[model samples]
Every structure is written in structure tokens, then in C-alpha cells.
Target chain A: MHLLSIRDLVVKFRTHDGTVHAVNGVSFDLDEGETLGLVGESGCGKSVTNLAVMRLLPKPAGHIEGGEVVFQGQDLLRLDESEMRDLRGKEIAMIFQDPMTSLNPVLTIEEQMVETIRAHRRVSKSQARARSLELLTMVGIPKPETRLRNYPHQFSGGMRQRVMIAIALALEPKLLIADEPTTALDVTIQAQVLDLLQRLAADLGTAVILITHDLGVVAGMTSRLNVMYAGFVVESASTPDLFARPRHPYTVGLLHSMPRLDAQPGEPLIPIEGVPPDLRRAPVGCPFAPRCAWRLESCWTGMPSLEPIDQTAQIVTTGPNVTHRVACWNPATPDEAVAARPLREGFTPAAAPAEAVA
Target chain B: MSGVTGQPAPGAAVGVASTGTEPGRPLLEITDLRMYFPISSGILISRHVGDVRAVDGVTLAIQKGETVGLVGESGCGKSTVGRTILRLYRPTSGRIVIDGQDITWAEGSTLRAMRRRMQMIFQDPYASLNPRMTAAGIVSEPLEIHGVGSSSERRERVRDLLATVGLDPDYGDRYPHEFSGGQRQRIGVARALALHPDLIVADEPISALDVSIQAQIINLMERLQGEFGLTYLFIAHDLSVVRHISDRIAVMYLGRLVETATSRELYDRPIHPYTVALLSAVPIPDPAIERKRRRIILTGDVPSPSDPPPGCHFHTRCWLRARLGNPERCVVEAPALRELASGHAVACHFAEEVDGSPEQVLQVTGEGMGGSSSRRADDSPTGRVAAAGPGLAT
Candidate 1:
């Protein structure tokens, strides 16, 4: 069985403006010690989906309308508040994008780390302090003995993130969810932090869900990824396969939109025109049809289900070797993606309805 | 290199604010610009202990219609250089000659006039725009500030500006909160262009934008630059975006210009070790290329800029210096930004060693090395020298 499986998870926010459909029928599976990447632009439910997994969604507004978060053959969604709280720091750990905000400014590193370890393990304060020091060392902080007494404000941005990591991994959780861990860092420091996260996750045999917007980050770190748009997983595949042969037009547009480092100077970037769909009014049809170049005539009529690109792709395993699936009506071929044109003859979309206009 | 392609700019002689000077002179010239913020201590006494030295010394010249990119990691003072040149902060000492006029100490009316010729595009579109003001009111504020035209004429100009930035003229009635991030940035661009400025200081203009929206803004900026003959001082942390939009790129490290070269030259033959390290750190998007690339992951965080190291600000984390057995010269004296080629300059004692080295992006040590242990060990003589440099062979 997979380490974690999310089946048709739907989440919504009750805002003063109206109901915001943040996550809609999102489902994916993760394996033991596997690394999964969630890539998307802002407002795409990538962070919301992961937040639902930990049951840390804000109360009174964020409602998990429907879903099943199956972890270790247990329905984590059905767990009560106390049971979920015990599992939060012990079995699943999370690293946020802005370490300064996520970390407690008033508490010293020692206090926070010890509290986390002692809360879940029933260990003594001194014992928890020793484990915290060991974790800080593992995460490459200098002079852990002295640094432990330092407050969060004392450390630099990178060091604060390292301390956050050390605290997150204090109990050696089974799964680690790093939501844009390096987005707030400089490139040089970002490189250091990414390397550390990858190495530590490997050493501890921990599954990781790395959520980020940069395609470059996911390419180097995660084995498999799900490309999301408008609260739906538009595409999913192994890292190589996703980059090599992206079947979804939205994925193709995203890849082309980014200005690559290795690309020749003055190379023109083809932007995916038009803004994303509004989820306030629940997404209708394919949310990406307005921006997708490979839209079919029927794409605006209804949403497409996630299906295997090839008819013969087998579901033999649950990890990176899983089957490639796309939630696209008229998918792109390798040649179409290369030339950025519709190779399929019948996919020349008719006039889009005025109701879908941005 | 820029002189050849830069002279074709149409407004070199037609500059409305141009003073008596040679027409061939660059649009913006800054010499030894320094902006040191005072660090005060003791609330009762209010004593100035030291200066933060935000922008210690930066020198550059941007020709008419040339886009000069200033790039660095955050807090490296690239933005401070931009802000200082624009006279936002009173510089500690320097000369800023823009379009043959010295604006370094320009007072009141003169400074206000100088500001009209220079405009700014801020990083965050959300916070930059006034939430309560209408789009037309925001864009026309610059026109009203300068008393450029009548009320009706200013309204007409605002419409044209909005249309020029790809926003609908009809949306001028809407507020900033109603627009998306990209549209709000477009409104910001329109505001910057209202004064018909000769130079635009874009401070991380697209960093807060989404990836797809970033491309849109870049394209719009390029198109507008071509149409208006505008020179740009583009400051950003993203190396790839800077390389794409810039003709000449200047790399800053801890308030100093470490390297300045043409975009192609800097990418191909970077002389400064910091520039090389910065380039290697940017992750490429291709999985195939990433597998083969050996990244030089920097060991530690950038030091506090207030009390930067005496000799070389970057000596603390420099991979090339570590590879060179921790050269004593780098520790004793600061290296000047000396020109090695016609347009390429580097500030390093061992500039020759790093100029064309193939190990520019190659990995120094691929295995696990703790940040503290590696930084400490590199300082000692019994060192595990990161001895992988062809530069070191000589």
C-alpha cells in the first residue's frame, strides 16, 4: 500500500465575498520514502491541498467538504482533533516558506524544539534538549550547544530556516511537507537549504511533499510531480517524463512560459495569455480551456477526468513509476509540444462561449 | 560593446531635459556612489555608532536606450544602488550625472525637475499602488505633480498611458483592488511612463509576479522601451530574467560592484568568483541538464552588511579563495574594480585565475559537508583545500 493516498479531496473557504472553491476533487497517491512535488502558480490550491492533509485548515471558514486522506491504511480525515494533533508533529512534519513568520519570535530555539519533541514522545526536558542539539547539528548549524539558546530573531534568514528544519525533524517524522521552503531565501542560500533538505530527508528515510512554484526546484528534487491549475491536478508524471513528453497543453504552456537559464540570449518566451479562472463561482468545464492552446470543441462543455495518456500504461507500482495521467480533453503530442501547435486535426477549438471570457 | 548598438537611439539629441554637453555622453553616469545608513544606539543619548554601508561604492554608465541590469542576492544592496542613483536617499558621497546635469546635490526645484526625468517602477504592485485611488487618478498624479497639462489633457494622457501598458482605457475608473496582479503591475508601469522619463529604475519589478505573468511584463517592458527610447536600470535577484532583459549586466556583492560585463560576455567569461558562484546557484529547469550540472552550493548565509569584513566582503564565503589555499592578499587589502578587458571589469585579487576557467559551474565537493565544519576547516592551513580549480594549477 502507498504511504499516503488522497482521494477526491475537496476544500472550500467561506469568505465575506462568497464561497471560494480553493481545492476541487484533488486526488493523488504517495509511496514510502517517496518525494512528490506540487507545482502551480499563486491561488492554485497547491498549498491548500497539503494543509488539508495535516488537518490544520483554519476553523470556522476552511471546510473540508469531502475527501479521504488515507495514511498508513488509516483515514486521517476522520481522526479527532487530539488524535490528529498527536500525529501532526510525530508522524508528519511541515516546513513553511517564511521561517520567520512560522517560528515563534518570543521563544528560544531550545524551548520550541524541546516542546515539540516532549509533546509527542513523553521524553524528559533534558533528553529532548539533547535530541534538539543533535538535530541542529544534522541540519548544519554551527556550535549547536550555544546556538540552541539563541532566539529566532538572533539567527539569519537561512539559519532560522535551518533551525525550523531541525525542529521539524526533531521526532524524525514519517513524512515531511516543505511548502516553498526556499522561496523566501536568496539563490545561493536557497541552494544550500535545498541540498540539506534533500540529504536529510534521504538519511531519515522520510517521504517528502515539496510544494513550490519554480520548475527548476522540482526538477532537481522531486521524483514525481502534479501540475495544478484552478484547484485541479492538470497533469501528473515522473519528473523526466513530465519534462520530456508533457501531454497536457497547460503543462506545455507553463514550461514555455518560464525563461530558462540555458536558453540562448533574446529567445522569445511564449506567454500563456489570459488569467486563471475564478473559483468563487465553482470552476466550470476545463478551467484551463481559456488559456490552453490545444483546447477541443468539447473542452468548454465539461471537465475532463484524469486518464492515462497511453491505453497500455500499467498501474503496477505506487511511486515514481506510476502511470502518467492527464486531466485534459485534447492532449498534446510530443511533436505538438515541441512545435507548440495543435497536431491533432479535430482539436481546432470553436469559438469559446462569451460566459468564459475573462 | 554598447556604443556600437546604442547610438541608434533617437532621443539622444532630442532629450527635453538635456543640458549643454556632448551628445555622445551616456544617459546616466554614477561614480563611486555610496549610501551608508547610520546605525544609532542608546535611545537616551542617540549616538551614531557606525554606518550600515548599504551601498559602499558603485560605479557605472548606462548609454541612451541601454538596459543595464544590476543583479545580486537579497541584501547585497543592488536595490540600494538603484535608490541612491535616483536620489531617494541622501548619499554619503558620490557624483551622479544624469543627462549632463549633476543631480547629486540638486536642491528643491532642481531635484524635483530631475525626478520628472527619472521614474521608478516598484517591486510589489499590491502595496505600490494606492488602494483607494482610481487607476486614472493614480496614473495622472505624476502629471499633476509636474503641472504638465490641463485637467482634460491630463485625463486624455492617462487614457493613452493605460492603453499603452495593455490595460483598457475604460478600466481607468476601477480601483487597484479590482485588478489582478499583472493588471496592477501594468497600472504601475503606466504611472512610471506618465512623466515621459528618460530613465526608469525598475526595482525587482517582476519578482512578485507569477511566472507566466512575469513573461508578459517583460515583454511589455521591452516593447515600451523600444517605443519610448527609454534607458533602464533594472535591479533584480533573478539572474535569468536580468540576463534576458539587460544589455550590460552589473553584479553586486555586499554593496560593491564585483563584476560588470556585457550580458553574453558575463555569462560566457565571468571573472569574479561571486558572479561564478551566483550563476552556478541558479537552478536550470531541464532535468537532463540538472543531472549533469555540478552546482556550487554556497556554504553559509551572507554576513551582516553593517559590519562587513574589512578586506573583501565576500572572502568569508568565497569558493575560489578557499580553492586558492586562502590567499593572504585577499585578506590584507580590498581589490579595486579594475578593467581586465574593454568593457568587462572584476574586483578580485585572482581575476586572471577565474576568467575562463571551465570549473566555473563545476561542483567543488559533491558529498556531504556541514556548513560550519567546511567554513571552519577552510580557514585552517591543514585544510581540505577544495582543490578542483584549473585556476589553481597555474
Candidate 2:
């Protein structure tokens, strides 16, 4: 059974001019103990999708227009505020992108952790403090006892991120939503943080939904991946299957554009042209049509439903279940002969019209 | 001038002859550059002194039309070196020669003119670009300050600059807040190009943007460089980004240059222990290689700059030092940056003798610095020293 499932989720923000459809008809599922990565560019609605699941979207300005967020056989969207609050810290916890903003500046680390523990459970102050120290040590922070008294400002960026992780793990929540947790960290620190997250998730049997703009990070850490375009999930598949055979043009572009550490210097990086479409006005068809290299005419006129490329064939023949699914009308065939064709390159901007896909 | 004769002060021109061949002269020469800010106590701040040596004794030369990358972790002072070159902050000591002109002491109009030839692209586009100013006004402000052209010409040039950076010319009338992060950064690039600068200092320009947008900006910069014959001083914490754009790469740590070499040389075979550790830490995309790849996890936080280590800035955490037996000299004397190969330079006491292979370095430091004490005896000089390796001072 799926641990969390999102179906046709639509989130919108009411602005001065009009409502902005930040997350439009996005859908995905995470199995028990599975790591799912949500990849997209800025303003692509990846963060909004996760926020919708957490029911943390700002009210008055933002609301979920339509969706069903099913978690452990219960619909989270149907839950009342008080019921959701009870489950929030104990069953589901989220680690935001910026640790500095997420943490309270005035409170000591011990005070913050104890409050979180006390809010969710009836525990003594000393017991709560001891549990907090254990969480801190589990996340790899040095000298947990000494660090408990320190304020957020005293810790370095990396340590602060580790503290955020510790707070997220306080209740041993079944699921964790980490939104670009290591984006601001240095590479070395980033590696350590990722390693810690992977190990803890496996040991504790906690599911994680990792939201990021970096394809390399997604490729490295995620078990399953979702490629998001303007407010929609363009592709979804297992990590190895996605990397081995990407179907959506947007996913292909993303994979090709990243400059990996293993790649030799001076090789030309293939960046997708143009920017993500404005979310204020939902597009009639594929949002990535303007930037996709292999976009067809149908992509601009009508939206494509998420469907299996071939119903008869399984996504991964070796896996226990077929999980790969893409929302592209003309998905690329995963064959060595077809993949061997040279990618189209060097098309001048002047020769091509701005809005035209081909 | 009191203590030194041949060496020049900060921003003064070094008198070293440029080999006289002059095919491509060094556009900027920085020698023994230092920028120190004092940490004080009490209300009146009346103490003897303690200083944070942000940029201490960094020597480098950027040739005309050559892109050089200054790479390091945060707090390493790469940004300070860039700011010092542009004279945004007054340096405490050392020399900065720009276009063969000594602008170290130049003030008022002279300094303003020097600023025209060198411009900076800041890291945070949202914070850097003034929200109050329109795109056109932001780009043309430099021209207006320098009095380079008339109002009409400046407007026309701003349009051209916008086009050059792959932004719509019509968007110039809009405010910075009206655009996305990538568009605002394009405007930042357009503003940087307004002066037709000889050299540009890009300080983590794409680190704030999305990865896909980062690729676009990097590609745009490369295209602009080829078209305008401009040189770039790219400063970033990511080695992959630096390797993609730089001809030569320099690694800095706690305000000092630890290694310098060609992009391929440094990435393929990093000589400095710190550089090796840093490279091993970056997560590669390929799952097979990533699993097999050796990772170096250095222990302990970076020491405060106000009280850096006594000798080498990196000695406290140097993987090579621990592997080759922690020499006493590493704690007493600092090693000078010397040429190991034709163009590669590394500043480590056992640069040549150390087994700098990624696997060896990772094996030594992977468990963190706690294992250093045990390996100290096995790697000591008395144990076994290679005969033909680089000579050790201790």
C-alpha cells in the first residue's frame, strides 16, 4: 500500500490581480520507506505540491482548490485543523530549505526541542531534554550536551541544518518532507547531510519526499523521481529507470544540462531555452512546450494525461512492481537503436521563433 | 615603505617584468594581498588588538582574456579577494596591479575611472539589484556616472546590452521585482556589461538561481565572453561550475591560496590535500561510481578566522599532514606556494611525497580526524621516507 498518495492536486494563491495556479493537477505516490524526489526549476510548483500535502499553505493568500491527499488510508485534506495539528509533529514533519528562518532565534536548541516534544507527547522536561540530545547526536552534531544550550546564531550553517534535521526527527515521524535542505550548504557538508539523511531514513523506516532544483542531488539520493514543470508532474519513475531511460523531453533536457563532476572540462552544457511559464494563467496544454526540444504540435493545443507508454509492457521488468509513468503524449521509446541518434543542437535563436516549439 | 623596499603595498603595481614577450599581458597582478579586520571589545572599543585575517597574502596573475576561477568553501575569503581587487574594501597590505596601472592609492576621480574597467556580478540577484530602479536605469547608471555617452546613446546601449544577455529589450522599463530570479540576474549581467569592462568579477552569480537557470546564465556568460573578448574572475564554492568555465583554477582556504593549476590538471589530479578532500566530497551523479567513490569527511568545524591556526591555515585539518606523519614543522612554519609541475603549484610540506590519490586520501581521512593520532607514527619521517620524492624541511 502507498504511504502517501496525491491525486490531481491544485493549489492557487489569491493575489491582487487574480489567482495564481501555483500547483495545477499535480499527482504522485510514495510507497512505504521510499524516497521520492520532486525536481523542477524555480516557480515550477514542486514546493507548492509538498506544502499542499503538509496543509501548510498560507491561508487567505493560498488554498488548495482541488485534491485528495491520502496518507495511511485517511484523506489528509478532509481532516479538521485540530486533527491535522495532532498528526503534524507526531506523524509528519517538514524540514524547510533555509534553516536560519525555520529555527527560532531567541530560543535555545534545548528549549525548542523540548517544546516540540512536549507539544506532541506528555513527557518530563528532563526526559525530553535527553531525547533531544539523542536526536542531535543521531544527526551527527558534535557535543550534543554543550550544543543544547547554544542559540541558532552560534552554530554554523551546516550545524544549524543538522539541528533542523534533529528537530524533524524528534517524534520519529513516519514521513519527512525536506525542501532543498542542503541547497545553501557547501559541497562537503552537503554530502555529509545527505549521507546522514539516507542512513537515518533506512534505519528508522521513515519515508522522505525530497524537493530540489538540482538534478544531480536527485539522481544520487532518490529511489523514485518526479519531474515537475509549470505546476504539474511531467514525469515519474524509479531512480535507475529514470536515469537509464527518461521519457519526458523536460526530464531529458534536465539530465543533459547538468555539469557533473565526473564529466571532463570544456564540454558544452546543453541548457533548455526560455524560462518556466507564468503560473498566474494556466496553460491550455503542456507548460514545457516552449522550452522542450522534441515538443510536438499537440503539446501546445491540449494537455496529456499521465498514462503508461505501453500497457502490456512493465516499466522495470526486474523490479517487484512497475512504477514508471510519464505525462507525455509522445514519450521517447527506450531502445538503444533509437537513443543512439544524435541530439539536435546548434539551432540559432534568430532562426527560430520565440513561441514556436519546432 | 617602512619595512619593505622591493615589494609593493596593497593595490600598488608589482615591478616584476612580464617576460617582455607581451603576447597577452597580465591584466591584474595581486601579490601578497592581505585584508584584516580587527575584532574589538568594550563600549569604546579600546583594546590593544585581535584581527580576523580574511584575505592573507594571496598572490595571483590573471592574463588578458583568460578566465581564472577562485574556488573554496565559505569563509575562505575568495569573495574578499574579489572585493579587494575592485577596491570595494580597502586592503590592509599587498599589491593590486590592474591593466599595468597602480590604483592602490588612487582616490576620487582616478578610483572612479579604475572602477569602470572592472565590474562585479554579485551572488544574490534579488538582493543585489535595487528594486526601486528600472532595468534601463540600473544598466545606464554606470554610463551616467562615467559620463561615457549622452542620454539617448546610453538608452540605446542599454537595449543592446539587454539583448546581449538574452533578455527582452522591452523589459527594460520594468522594475526588478517584476521579473523572476533568472531575469533579474540577466539584468545584473546587463548592468555589468554596461561599462564594456576589461575584466568581470562574477562572485557566485548562479548559486542563487535554479540549476536549469544556472546553466542558461553560464552559457550566456560564455557566449558573451567569446563575442566581446572579455576576461572573467569566476568565484564559486562548487568545483564543477568552476571547472566548466575556467582556464586556470586556484583553491583557497582560510584566506590563503593552497593550490593553483590548469582546470584539467586540478580536477584530474589535485595535488593539495585540501583540494583532494574537497573534490572527494562532491556527490557525482552516476550511481555506480557514486557508490564506489571514496568520500573524505573532515572532522571539526572550520576554526574561527579571528584566531586561525598558527602555521599553515589548513594544517589543523590537512589530510596529507596526518597521512605523512604530522610534522612539527607544519605547526611552526608555513609552506610557500611552489611549482610542482610546469604550471601546477601547491603549498604543502609533503606535496610530492604524499600519496594524493583520491582513494588513499579518502581512506586516511574518511573516518574523520579522530584516527589521526594512530597514523601519526606510521607516517613519521623515521619510519620510511621515499628517496626521490620532494625533500622535506623537517
Candidate 3:
């Protein structure tokens, strides 16, 4: 059974500029103990969908217009404030990108961890402190007892992130949402943090919603992947399968856009031409149609629904019960995408046309 | 001035451009550059506690019409190297020569004249360009300052530069806030090329843009380099991005150069243990390669720059030391940058072992490189010190 299932989520932000359609009808399911990756570029609504699921969207500006986040046979959207608070840290916990901003500088590590522990359970101060130390030690912090007295400012960026992980895993929640947790870190430190996260998630048997823009991180960390483009999941597949064969043009573009460390010298990267669509205006047909190389006539007429490719094929044999889905009308094979190589060199500015001077 | 073992002392080359390349061959040459920010404490009379030695003894030369990529993690002094070369920060010591002219202490009009040949393309476009100024005003400001052209000619040149950078000439009236990240970066590029600079220091030019837009800027830069015959000192932390755009790549760690080689040679055969660990740490996009690759995960965090390790800066987190059973030499003696092959240079005492290069060959080669084999031990700890075998010879 699924651990957390998001259905038809539509998130909108009513800013003074305009009503921005941030997330448009996104739906996905996370199985028990599964590490799911939500990947996209900046302002692509990957974070918005996760925020909507946690009901932590900023008030007065962001709104969950439509959606039902069903977790463990309960509709999280319908839960009252008190009941929601009861489940937030106990059942589902979240860690954000920037550790400096996420952690309070004035508070010591012990205070924050113990407060989180006490808020979720009926534990004494001493008991909570003991558990906090144990949690800190579990996250690989050295000299946990002595380090707990130091404030957040005393810890380095990677150490603070480790503290955040320790606090989130204190209760051993059923689900953990990590939003770009290692983006602010260096590569070596990023590797250490991710290795810690992967091991912790596996040992605790906790499902994780890993949100990041890096495909490399997703490939190494997650079991299943969801590729988001312009507020929608354009493609979904198992990790190995997704890398082996990307069925969506957007996925193919993203893959080719990166300058591969394994690529031959002097090989040029084929970046997706044109910027992402403006969310202030409603999208027509397909949001990626303007930049997609495999755009068809139907792509220009209506948006395609996300559906499994050959439901009866059963071609993916690496993982059990794996499914590959794509929301592209004229999806190109890897060869075809490669054939569409080298997007016209410096094509007209993709954003705006040439201006006529007086 | 210090920490230079293989070459002549940096102080000895003061006021004189180093030889090897002809007088006016390379566009820029930095000899043992150093920039140290002082740390002080107390109220009335502050005492100097220490110094954050950024860009400690970095010597490099960039040929005309070639791109040299400087890459490292944060606080590794890669950005400081770029800033110091442009004279944005006065070097605490060493020489900076541009086209056979030393500008280390150029004052008054000499500094102003030096500015025309060298320009900087900053990392953050949103913060670098003034939001109040129009794109045209920002691009043509250099021409107006140098008094190169009249008002109408400057306007015409601004439009041409805008068009050259793949931006619409009509967008000249738009402010920085009016453009997207990619477009704003183009404006930054246009501004950098305003005076037809001979050298451009692009410090992480495309880092802030989206994945799709980064390619546009990179392609535009490559085209501009071909057209104008410009030299670039591209600084970035991303290894793949640096390898893709650079002719030669230098790896820095804790204010010291660890490795320098042609992009292909470095990627194919990294001799320094730190470079090997850094290359392995980068999670390749391909799942097959990522799963099958051997990762050398280093322990502990980077040491504070102000209190860096005495012998080797990377010794605190060196995976090679652990693999070699905590070598004592790594903690007691420093290594000098020594050439292993034609174009590959590494600054590690045990660089010969990382690539399994035969010890006999390295011994014969190291003798010619001067003092690189000075630390050959009497009592070999690894027990395979001078063992002869047909290993991979570069």
C-alpha cells in the first residue's frame, strides 16, 4: 500500500502581480520505505507541491486550491489544526535547503532537539535530552554530549544540517521530506550528507520525498523519480530505467543539457531552447511545446495526460512492480533525441522578439 | 613569497615578468600571488590573531585566446585568485604581469589605463549590475568613461554589443530587474565586452542561471572568444562545467594548487589524491557508472583557513593518508607542485602512487624536475617503495 498519495494537487499563489498557477494538477504516490525524487529547475513548482502536501504553504499569499493528500488512510487536507499538529512531527517531518536560515542561531542544539521531542510525546526533560543526544550521535556528530551545548552558529553548515536530520529523525516518523538539503553544501560534504541520509532512511524503514534540481543526486539517492516541468510531472520511472530510457522530451532535454563528466572532449551540450513559460498566464496546449523538439500537432492543441507506457509490456525487470509513465504526445526515443542534436546555434532570442526602434 | 619549493622564490621575480613564454605571448601571468585577510580581536588596541591566507602562492600563466579554468570548493581561494589578478584586491605579495607590463603597484592613470585591457564578469548578475541603470547605459558606461567615442557612437556600439551577445538591440531601455536571469547575464557579458578587453575574468558566469539557460551563455561566450580572440580565466566549482569550457584546468584546495593539466589529461588521469576523491565524489548522472564507481569518501570537514594544517592543507581530510596507514610525512613535510607528464602537475608527495605510475619511471623523471625526489625514504614504510613493474606509464 502507498505511504503517501497526492491526488490532483493544484497550488496557486495570489501575489500582487497576478494569480500564479504554481502547481497544476500534479498526482503521485509513494510506497512504504520508498525513496522518491522530485526533480525540476527553479520556479518549476517542485517545492510548491511538497509544501502543499505538508500544509505549510505561506498564508495570505499561497493557497491550496484543490488536492487531497492521503497518508496512511487519512486525508491530511481535512485534518483539524490540533490533529494536524499531532501528526506533523510524529508522522511526517520536513527539512529545508538552507540550514543557516532553517535553524535558530540563538538556540543551542539541545534545546531545539529536546523541544521537538517533548512536543511530540509525553517525555520528561531529562529523558528528552538523553534521546536528543542519542539522535545526534546517530547522525554521526562527534562528541554529541559536549556539542549539544553549542549554539547553531558554532556548528558548520554541514554539521548544522546533520543536526537538522537528527532532529527530524528523533521521532522516527513514517515519512520524511527533504527539500534540497545538500544544495548549499560542497560536493564532498554533499556526498557525506547524502550517504548519511540514504543509510538512515534505509535503516529506519522510512519513506522519503527528496526534492532537488540535480539529476545526479536523484539518480544516486532515490529508487523512483518524478521529473517535473512547469508545475507538472512530465515523466515517472524507476531510477535505473529513467536513466536508461527517458520517454519524455523534457527529460531527454534535461539529460542532454548537463555537460557529462564521461562525455568526449569538445562535445557541445544541447540545452533546451527558450525559457520556461510564465506562470502568471494560463498555459495553453503544452507548456513545453514552445521549446520541445518533438512537439506534434496534438501537443499544440491540448495537454496530454500522464499515463503508463505500454501497461502490459512488463519490460522493466530490474525492480518489482515498476511502471513508466510519460505525458508527451510525440515522445522521441533516445536516438531521435540525439538526432535532434545541437539546437540551432543562437536561434532568435527565445524570450522576446526584436524590438522596432523609432 | 613562501611555500614555493620547486621554482625560484616569488620575491625574486618581483618587478620582472617571469620567462618561458615570450615577453608579449601570454596575456596574463601571476607569480606566487597571495591575498591574506587579517583577523583582529579586542576593542581599543586590536591584536592580529592570524590571517586567512587566501590564494597562497598561486603561480599561473594564461596564453592569449585560451581559457584556463580554476576550480575548487568554497573558501578554496579560486574566486580570490580571479579578484586578485584583476587588481580588485591588492595582493599582499607577488607579481601580476599582463602583456609584459607589471601592474602590481600601478597607481593613478596607469591603473586607469590598465583597466581598459582587463574586465570582470561577475557571478551574480542581479547584484552586479545596477538596477536603476538601463541596459544601454550599463554597457556603454565603459566607453563613456574612457572617452573613446561620442554620445551617438557609444550608443551605436552599445547596440552592436547587445546584438553580439545574442540580446535584442531594442532591449537597451530595459532595467536589470526587467530581464530574466539568462538575459541579465547576457547584459553582464555585453558590459564586459564594451571596451574590447583583451582578457575577461568570468567568475562563475552561468552558475545562477537554470540548467537550460547555462548552455546559452556558455555557447555565447565560446562564440565571442572565437570572434574577438579573448583570453578567459574562468572560475567555477563545478568540475564538469569547468572541464567542458576550459583548455586547461587547475584544482585548488585550501588556498593551494593541487593539480593542473589539460582538461582531458586531468579528467583521464588525476594524480593527486584530493583530485581523485573530488572526481569520485561528483555523482555522475549515469546510474550504471555511479553504481559501479569506487568512491573514496574522506572523513572530517575542511580545516579553518586561518588555522590551516602546517604541512599539507588537505592532510586533515586526505583519504590517501588513511589508505596509506596515516603516513607521517604528510603531516611533517609539504609537497611542491611537480610535473608528472608533459602537461600534468601535482603537488603531493605520493602523487606517483595514485595513478600506479611505476616508481622507477617516476624516480628517473623526478630527478630531472629538481628536488621532487628529495624525500625518498631510507626506511620504506609501504614496502613497495622502489619495486619495479610494468605499471601504467603516462
Top-DockQ candidate index: 1
DockQ of each: 0.54, 0.43, 0.43
Model 2 earns a TM-score of 0.89
True contacts kept of 3: 0.63
Q: Rounded to one decimal, what is candidate 1's iRMSD? A: 5.6
lDDT of 3 by residue, A50-117 (tens): 88878899998999888889999898999988999999879999999998887888899999988999
Which ten residues in a row are the worst by lDDT in model 2 chain B? B373-382
Clash count (model 2, backbone only):
3
* Regions of candidate 2 where Cα sits further than 4 Å from its true position: A314-321, A333-358, B1-24, B45-48, B353-355, B365-394
lDDT of each: 0.84, 0.79, 0.81
Identify the candidate with maximal TM-score: 1
Give residue B201's error in model 2 in angstroms: 1.0
> Candidate 1, residues A1-358: lDDT per residue as tens digits?
8899999999999999899999999999998789999999988999999999999888889999998999999999999999999999789999999999988999999999999998988789999999998999999899999999999999988999999899888888999999999999999899889888888888899999999999999988888989999899988899888999998888898888788766778888887888887789888889888787877678887999888888687753357577889998889889989777787767566568776665
Q: CA shift at B80, candidate 3, in angstroms? A: 0.7
Candidate 1 regions with alpha-carbon error over 4 angstroms: A343-348, A354-358, B1-22, B355-363, B366-393
Superposed by TM-score, candidate 2 places the C-alpha of residue B12 at a distance from the truth, in angstroms, of: 32
State every prediction's TM-score relative to the real structure.
Answer: 0.93, 0.89, 0.89
Docking class of 1: medium
Clashes of each: 0, 3, 0
